[model samples]
Target: MKLSILDQAPISSNQSPREALQESLKLAQAGENLGYTRYWIAEHHDLPGLACSAPEVMLGYIGSNTKKIRIGSGAVLLPHYKPYKVAEVYNMLATLFPNRIDVGIGRAPGGSAEATNALSDNFLQQVWNMPNSVQDLLYFLDNDIPTEHHHARVSASPIPLIPPIPWLLGTSKKSAILAAEKGLAYAFGQFMSDQDGGAIIKQYKDHFKPRKHNESPQVIVTVTAICAETSEKADEIALSSLVWGLQRKRGEETHGVPDIQDAKDYLRNEKDGLLDDMKKGMIIGNPQEVKKAFLTLQDQYNADEIMIVTITHSPLDKIQSYRLIAEEILK
Candidate 1:
């Protein structure tokens, strides 16, 4: 399986913007050395913890730093951005990076209502129209549809002769059907539990029809991966990072990741809801344990690619986790 890195660039307590960006670059460099196929940044707006609000700009930086690893959005949160603009940005990246840029698109806003409203006026409508809007965006990027014939036309300068590989990022069956119909690759989020990735992969492969851009179906699974010396250590590291997600679910708007002490204290006081959520879907363990779990997932889904998202309070810890996984499971 091909290994890739997915980063939300979570800002930890006492970390500045510059520090976060530098840390992300360090992680990207580490992934490159570890033989990862790609490094993807997630888009999340108006959130203090997530500094990857502008993935395209961040991708340009990542592209400049890494020599061989591919750089792109794990997802660009298509709903908030204009489809034409996204096509142009990704096309430019592909041109700059040649064969090393990927464009993974998703429907979610990756933020709360207040944040979404702050980013765009029509965020809700844009999200609702994503399935159709993305189709149009793909058409413009892949084919030269004339402006006169079509009411709207989007043209890019130094047009991307080589199209970026398209990936549909979702955690639902609806996304699977759309990906299959479009013959695009699908990446299932590891956080979701109601949807079975194996079933979706089967549906995608069975119903796939080749388009001009894609000749076959490709399935990728994105999982929360934290590999350390032992399962207990991995879990401890993961628990702290995961508290941010739990807080979000609880409608709390906090910026930056909490410290291990803070997370431990919070978990001790509150009910185990957050901890339960993490254990239910996450993969946190040592090399052997993680490998066993991942192998089962791969075997069940017959996944073509695996993207690992390592969430941590420290960049060094994050890089170490990914490094351990690459050295042991991926080797």
Candidate 2:
């Protein structure tokens, strides 16, 4: 199975944003060396524990540092920007990287309500007009705006010889349908969504309408996982993210990912069931067990690739987890 990374640039309790981004670059380099297919960075804003706010900018740094493996935005949060501008930025990236860029798009605001307000004038309306925006963006990328269209005379400049591949990132059936209708590859964010991923992906394939000759539906399933030499160690590493996620859900502001020991202490008074529920959406195990879980998800979603998101208090541990999973699965 094809393996890839989806990095959120999670900041550790004692690490600066610069350090987290440096870790992201190291992870991308490691992924390429391990024979992974892609390395996608996420976009987040006004989130203390997450460092990335501009995936395009991060991709530039990563692309210069790594070779071969595809580099992209996990999802560009399309609702906040103009289609033409988005096309211009990624098209320039495709030109620089040359057949190694993927432009993953999403409609989510990618931030809190206040952040959303700060980023866009009318976030909801922008989301409601997502389909048209997607079409416009795609047309700009292809440099094929219809003559009758209002913006026909304009162009998304710096067009590359080969355009970047577009993947629609979503978590629901409506998103699946939109992706299918647009003939874009669909990436389901299983780590974030509570929806039936298999059903959603199946719906995407069922409704897929090719925009180009010989085009076919493509799928990627992104999941949260932590792999180590032993299941116990993996579970221990996962606690940091689990506790941090809980705090976020409870509307608590955290400085960064708590230390593993701190996570253990915080969970002591919490209900055991809360931790169990969080684990339901995550695959925390040894290398072999993690591989098995990934295979199950692959078959269930009929996915072409598995994009993993691993968060830990130590950046080294996060890199180690990816190494363990890659060694076992790619072997």
Off by over 4 Å in 1: 146-154, 253-255, 271-274
Candidate with the greatest TM-score versus the true structure: 2
Each model's lDDT: 0.81, 0.94
Model 1, 1-331: lDDT tens digits are 6788888888887798778888999989999999988898988877767787788898889888889898888788888777778888888898898888888989887877898888788987887787887787677667566566452554744477688888888888888888888778788886554677788778888988787643877887888888889988888888777787788778787767877777887788777664775577788899888888888888888988788888888777788898888888668
Q: Write the per-residue lDDT of candidate 2 for residues 95-195, one digit (tens) a residue.
A: 99999999999998888999999999888999999999999999999999999989999988898998999999999999999999999999999998999
How many clashes in each candidate? 0, 0
TM-score of 2: 0.98
Cα lDDT for residue 220, model 1? 79
Please, what's the RMSD in Å of model 1? 2.2
